[model samples]
Target chain A: MAYWLQQILNALQLSSIYALIALGYTMVYGIINLINFAHGDVFMVGSFCCFMAAAFLGLSFLPALLLSMIGSAFLGVAIERLAYKPLRQAPRVSAIITALGVGIFIENFTLSLAPYPKVIPPLLKNITWALGGVTFSSLQLIIILLSIGLMFFLDYIVYRTPVGMAMRAISWDKTYVPLMGVPVDFIISITFALGAGLAGAAGTMYGLAYPVIDPYMGIMVGWKAFIAAVVGGIGNIRGAVIGSFILGTVEIMVVAFFPSTYRDFVAFTLLLLLIIIRPYGILGKPRTQKV
Target chain B: MNMHRDILLEVRDLQVSYGHIKAVKGVSFTVRRGEIVTLIGANGAGKSSILKAISGLIPYTGHILFNNQDLQKIPAHKIVDLGISQVPEGRGIFGNLTVQENLRLAAWQRGDKQEIATDYDRVYTTFPQLKERCHQLGETLSGGEQQMLAVGRALMSRAKLVLLDEPSMGLSPLLVREIFKVIAEINLNGATILLVEQNANMALRLASRAYVLETGSVIMSGGGKLLSDPRVRAAYLGA
Candidate 1:
């Protein structure tokens, strides 16, 4: 029981990061139906932003986190406007190719600037707590709790607010929404901002936990989060969170029971099996084309 | 032929094209205030295209002046701010949204809270069925109910000029009558209506004036009683 509880805690910590990055993938896909391949690099930028703030600016943990999030949000919006906006009317293949190119550009750009991985200095003092034979760290608690808080805040914005209503409306029919006097371009920018901001938060948390920052870190993590979004349902919010936790648990359990090297193999096989079983994903509703 | 009447919308030599196929070829018309002006035509006659241009949905050449302001200067969103709303063909409701949300979205530009609330009441009063199904997803509504919701949404925006493209499309005869009655009521309440329809018989009955469009041009024009004209009867009324 204690072993299981510890594994669950581990799952939650990993899931928090995955869920954050997955939301960025899901949101960009939901509104524009573009995969936004650069989303992972945005996550990478977040970590570096936090590191720069803490190391150079000499800011504390909270301020550094905020700066990273805000910086990432602006970067996301800039990417959408400068890179994706002109391609809005282009073929789906063109837009997708452009996304891949953008991702590569960000990765290479970051690699050029920082050729070596930098250690993130410990901002939070290490404190461990054991409850009923289940040991946990303060960083784990903060990551889990903050992920939940951000998710709830995102949920409120997407479901309750006027801007959220416009987002949902745009997702339904991009052509007709502007007729209602809603600024479609501006709303899309907001969506990008929110999604990237969440990714920034995730990047900061991951850096704190692992204590290493690199330009290429987002490559693998972003892919995993994207898979989580697909498993949950690409366009569904609640599903992304559920999917991340499932992926996190499965990855941890696979390592515990089997060779650690089998981690990616088993995780990906499960995702493939799920796709074969349910092509539209867990929460995705099959759309009926109207004549 | 009263030139002194209050003109709310004027389209002069307007032309629209898709690729190389010109959909609206130098079509011109006027919608006077306080009147139901209709354009009746066959499938490819560019009736809907003209409305699309007026509402800034597509790029067009020539001039469209809504209240004497050039429509070329307006974007699709700003067209609504100018008090012109189009219930585009196929009742473009946001299917995932609840009926009330659909109505509220139409009021996107309105900032006055109290007035918006009263407009909600007015929509509910006009379409009581919409009121009952306000919380239901838009796609769940019956065809007639959806039409009502579409019109209700147009009204929610405080539209002075409502451009309706085939409100009677795919509806049963009884439901069509209900929709037409509501259109008349909406007009009586001081909203100018520009209706486009294939159902010439019903459209002629409701319109104060009518234009006959044939293959992207206005071929004929007259008062509502033009239904009696032998040319109209032969071509449109199917005499």
Candidate 2:
């Protein structure tokens, strides 16, 4: 029972991180219909930024986290302007290829600069509490709480705010939104920035918990978060969160019970099965064609 | 309302070609202030192409001047800023946005908060059904309601001139009449309207001046009453 409880807590912590990054993917895909392959690299950049801010600037943990988020967001906007904006009117295939190129570029650039993996400083490594024989680190608690808070905040912005309404409008029909006098391109850029900022926050938190940072950290996490986005329903907020938790829990449980080496295969196989069974995803509405 | 002033919109020798096909060729027309003009034609007669060209959605070689300013160089969104709003074919409402949100988006460029609030209430008053479904997503609305939302959205832009492209398309006969009635009301409330329709009879009835487009050019241009001529009746009205 104690072992099970620990596994559950572990799954929840991992799931929370996945959910944070997945939100970024899902939100960008929702409005622009682009996969933003560089999104993962943006996450990796966030971890590096946090590390630099803490080590070089001697900033405390919280300020470093905030600086990391701002830095990643700026990088995201730059990526969009430099890589994605020029191809806004280009074919989807071209945009997808460009995004992939950006991902590769960022990873290689980071590898060239850092050249070696670095350990994340143990800022919140203190074990604060043990509930039901399951120890919880302060970082774990912060990660869980921060992820939930951000998700709720995103929900409110999407459902209650005017900008959220404009995003939904643009996603549904881009041409019509412009005719309505809403600057469609500006709204799209803002969406990218917001998603990037969230990914940055997630990256910072992930680094703190794991205590290891690498230039290529974003690739696997990005793939898993993308899978989570797909499983939840690519454009649905609640769907992404639900999908992340499911993916995280199942991954942890599989590794806990079975061979850890089979974890990737099992998770991917489940995603493939879900796709074949329900292509629109668990929460996505079926697109109807006009006759 | 100032008829003595310069022309509000002028299209001189407009020519639009799609690949090897000429959709609109040497089409010329003028819209004066506060006038309700209609362009009536058959399905392939290029009525929509002209509107699309004027709104800068399609590239065309033409001298399109609005208030003595050239419009061929501007993009579609900039054209809206120039005070020409198009309620395009099929009532292009943002299906996922709520009615109020749709209206708010239309008023995005306008910074007058009080005026926007007043306009919101005015739109609600103009279409009570829209007010009842203010918070409802556009897709959930019926076809008629969607059409109302489209027109209401256009009005929210506070445009000086509105280009309506087949507003009556796919609507029930009753809804079609209601839509035309709203168009007339909109004109009465002070916006210049340039309407295009396949239904020549309805177009002739609602408009003061009418242009008959056949194939890719205007075959005839006269007062709305003259649209009942024998040739127009046979070609466009299928008499």
Candidate with the greatest TM-score versus the true structure: 1
Put down candidate 1 lDDT per residue, B1-239, tens digits, no spaces. 45544899999999999999999999999999999999999999999889989988899999999888898977899889999998989988888889998988899998888988899999999899988999999989987888999999999998999999999999999999999999999999999999999999999999999999999999999997789989888987889
Poorest 10 consecutive residues of model 1 chain B by lDDT?
B1-10
lDDT of 2 by residue, A106-224 (tens): 99999999999987776554667887787877888888998898888888888777778788877776766667666777788778888888899899998888768998999999999
Top candidate, metric DockQ = 1
RMSD in angstroms, all models?
Answer: 1.4, 2.2
Residues B1-239, candidate 2: write the lDDT tens digits.
35537468899999999999999989999988888899988898898889888888789997999988899888777889989999988888877788988888788778898998999998888889999999998889998898898899888888999999998888899999998999999999899999999877888889988888889998888887756699989876889
Chain B alone vs. reference chain B, TM-score for every model? 0.97, 0.95
- What would the per-residue lDDT of candidate 1 be over residues A1-291, giving only the tens digit for each residue? 998989989989999999999999998998999998899999999999888888889888899899999999999999999999999999988999999899999999999999999888887887999999999999899999999999999999998877888898888878889778888999999999999999999989899998788899999999999999999989888889988998999999988789989999999999989988988779987889664
Q: List the residue pairs that clash in candidate 1.
A: none
Residue pairs whose backbone atoms clash in candidate 2: none
Chain A TM-score of each candidate structure, as shown:
0.98, 0.96
Which of the numbered candidates is closest to the native, going by highest lDDT?
A: 1
Query: Candidate 1 at residue B154, lDDT?
Result: 92
